[model samples]
Target: MRLEQADPKRLVAESYRIEGITDGECRSIFIDWALSLPVGVDARQAIKRLLAEYRGTAPDHPMTAVLRAGLHKAPQARRRGGARGRRI
Candidate 1:
């Protein structure tokens, strides 16, 4: 669920809540969570907030790595010229 001003994906939050959850499962949920975000949302900031919230609780959880990866990931630029439009 979206916290105050963070707007983190609910799936990600729920994944963290799952007991004995696997890294693969969390990774899958993370993919969905990332995809569900609105365009232009600051994913790194959201992930940082999430990590802060869960820090002392699940330090060893696989979600921590996933969140960290999300945080460190560079913003991807949209790739154009796939043959959709615009002749050079």
Candidate 2:
């Protein structure tokens, strides 16, 4: 996927330009990027595309690590109200 499609807001791209950016900051920026994507855009594909775009130039970047972590995290389904959610 094109960088434009993956990161329309350029949040991830801009994060790389910020010097000394921390992992927490990267994570925050990544969240912003994720939230900015158009509905129906696959976030993992976007993250992978961003990773591919930047990895060679900034493998050590905190954003890179955040993107990698984003790729690995599984979507966990949780009950909205615990056992009370169960129909008796």
| TM-scores for all predictions | 0.69, 0.83
Query: Global CA lDDT of candidate 1, please?
Result: 0.76
lDDT of each: 0.76, 0.90
Count residue pairs with overlapping backbones in model 1. 1
Candidate 2's TM-score:
0.83
lDDT at 65, model 1: 81
- Give lDDT tens digits, candidate 2, residues 7-41: 99889999999999998898888888888899989
lDDT of 2: 0.90
In lDDT terms, which candidate is top? Answer: 2
Choose the strongest candidate by TM-score: 2
User: Candidate 1 — which residues are off by over 4 angstroms?
Assistant: 1-9, 74-88
User: Candidate 1, residues 33-80: lDDT per residue as tens digits?
Assistant: 778777776777777777888867888889888888876648888757
